[model samples]
Target chain A: MTDEKDFLSGYDPGDFPAFAVTADVVLLTMRAGRLCVLLIERGGPPFKGMWAFPGGFVKLDENLDQAASRELQEETGISGIDLTQFASYGDPDRDPRMRVVTVSYLAVVPDLPSPQASTDAAKARFWPVDDVEGTLAFDHDRILGDALSHLRTVVEYSPLAASFCEREFTVADLRRVYESIWGVDLDPSNFQRKVLGIDDFLVPTDRQSSSSAGGGRPARLYRLGKVSELRPPILPPD
Target chain B: MTDEKDFLSGYDPGDFPAFAVTADVVLLTMRAGRLCVLLIERGGPPFKGMWAFPGGFVKLDENLDQAASRELQEETGISGIDLTQFASYGDPDRDPRMRVVTVSYLAVVPDLPSPQASTDAAKARFWPVDDVEGTLAFDHDRILGDALSHLRTVVEYSPLAASFCEREFTVADLRRVYESIWGVDLDPSNFQRKVLGIDDFLVPTDRQSSSSAGGGRPARLYRLGKVSELRPPILPPD
Candidate 1:
């Protein structure tokens, strides 16, 4: 073959462009009735004092998912939660230093303790999507937008949205998750009917609870049912 | 930074691992009312004589899409067809010679002339998805399965399945595309109603055609309409 990196030829594995692979996380949670992403302030020279998503180069010996978990644990002291990759950004020029292809994941959690910034980050904090003012480091702004769109698409058709709620949750908690992320006001009756209608959408349990703030009617507790996808899928607001 | 490839340092771009990026295509069409993919037999070492998806390493300059189009043109003499990437596969062991991550695209066309194999391929032909016997070279079997799953998922919620039909087609043509790809027997009446019910799923034109096999009533002609997505999506068979 004319090229040295040919799959047929026993060429040096290092002949590849060797683009540094990185994982950028769009860690989201419903904070104060809004969707927030965990971000960091760069403490290093390239983008000193600038904000960016918590991410790092993928290690040579690990899978991209493993690299993501490792980066989260190393940078934000947050791990063990589910992280679904939504998109991979690799516009040759996306990274200034070299050809860096970053796979971005969207993570929605029920609770998160205050993060302790490590590695090259000076500080770490959760920034509400709307309140995330100013520019983000590299192409993180576009990556965040892509992740949010993917999240919106995923929540509309998949059961992963329930992962944002407590193990035992009322319908209100599920409704709130959709409302917060979708930024819409869904009629509760219609939403519940649509969710329950999906085959195995939710499994009703014996546990019940009422809001601590007021003694409202006791709500049924349910777990994420056997269904991984919704049918007559949830349509986005027109 | 302790690591040489650290993004924070604004270091030399050359220090990154520079893994090779490639693109594979899953070109599908309806032949005798069955969905088939275009594949090639490798003529060179390492998987020589094995059937594989048409692909090549990305050039130093062109984007992934460009590279895919170029490869298809070079190997099969097919060009200008719209090919959308469905998934990207990257595992260190996926490729034997080097770490090559591939973005796989899926293209659906109404008809295709016999392929002219060039480059490293010894032969090229269309293989029905249901009849693809033996193992495909590399990780293509998994990639094709992923693309088919994605295609099934897309047709349920989007109108892209019409891409497999001629520019002007009848309702039966559109129905066959879905049925062939999904491997389901959709009720004609139900399929027609569901398709027409979706807002702007089809735009009727003045053209008409009758089946050559029988002297049947002429069927009305229609084209892809403005609606990009289907609400209350068409669910798959149980």
Candidate 2:
């Protein structure tokens, strides 16, 4: 007790190196049959003019999730999207300005309107996940890869793929969501059978597609399921 | 670009409130047919004497995962445990000393030797998950709840439940691990059917438990299979 009291009496936070925390967001949405990630063109030094996830320093008052939402809203003028804190990155040399540890958030939504850039971003847009040309600023390239991998896994077990569809969609539409994100051509009948086999995975509506795009039969429409997770997940092809 | 340049020119990490980062670990293991978590007694003021997860400030040179492992070893004298970064905690007033953000890791293993406390921890021991008496120091109570929920879910889809058992175990031993952690009574025959249905979930071994405590036929022992995930997750009873 005497040794502990003595140590506590002289304990100082200043003894440790200063750490700055930031929240970065990897916002994903389906656009034109492709998975796209929201990126910003940095307008200042420290990877200026390079692309990176929409993010900024976490404020003193707000929590990490709030900081991530605020950064997304401030930089891209897009808000009201549900965000999940997926992972945190804290490599000592990740940021040049200081020892910055970033908590990364992930959000996947249906297609969104074009982003309006502000703050330290020269421009904001959703780039196809596979089409990003060069390295992202900082360790964002790694963060993006992690977020994508996480997204791929979750969609298999959760109703997250429905998040990319409209309120009511046909089996083909849902299959396309899996195909675009997983980057695999799944047999239409097989995909439908797998998804339908999962109890409560889909709620069939008493309607069909207005236009018979195939000129044979209008696909049956369905809504999101009552349950959140998919038992017997629809596994992608090898 | 001009506005961004001006903002960057005056950007100083020092301007924001000083922040500290730490790593905490939730060490879980099966003991006496119960799930237990390793906790340490704080030796200093501000919740002194309260039991909390083994943790300390993260060093400048180490990454979050490395920091978590180091803290677990430094405080509890336990090493070689596999740790997964489950979540991060960064409420503004979580720590009275300063604005501290903590990355929390979770580890489950076969029973370990009794812990020996050091560093700022006055004592260390494994407490049954159901028997944690008082509120844990800081936001650890919430962190513990989250870690438990995550453990329960992962065990259903992944081969993590086997982590609590010996290298080779019987179907009954494996069932006990899930039943203990999930707090449920599972029918033995039904449980065996569910597990065996999963492809590559359990590999049959040529040995059986020598002592058939039940004066009956000895149960066959098996090891973990090659597949990491279970395609059709064994959902807990509603």
User: Model 2, A1-238: lDDT tens per residue?
Assistant: 2222222224775665578888888988888899888887776778887788877777788899898887777766678877899899998888777788889999887786544434444577889988883578888889989898888888877888888888898888888899998888999988888888888888999998986556767889999888777876667776
Show the colliding residue pairs in model 1.
A17-B18, A18-B17, A18-B18, A18-B19, A19-B18, A19-B19
Residue-level lDDT of model 1, residues A1-238, one tens digit each, is: 2442234444554654555677778888777677888887776666677778877776666767887887777776678888877667677666666666777787878756445444454577888887774478788888888878878888888887898787888888889888987888989899888888888988899989766576777889998888877775777677
Native-vs-model 1 lDDT?
Answer: 0.76
Predicted candidate 1 versus true structure: per-residue lDDT over B70-141, tens digit per residue: 877776777888888766777767777667778788887777654444345456788898777447888888
Model 1 Cα shift for residue A226 (angstroms):
2.4
Which residue pairs collide, candidate 2?
none
Give per-residue CA lDDT, model 2, range B1-238, as digits (tens): 3322222224865665567888888989999899999887676777887778877777788889898887777666678878889899999988777788989999888887544534444467889988884578888899999999899888877888888888899999999998997889999999999998889989998888886555877889999898787867777876
Candidate achieving the largest lDDT: 2
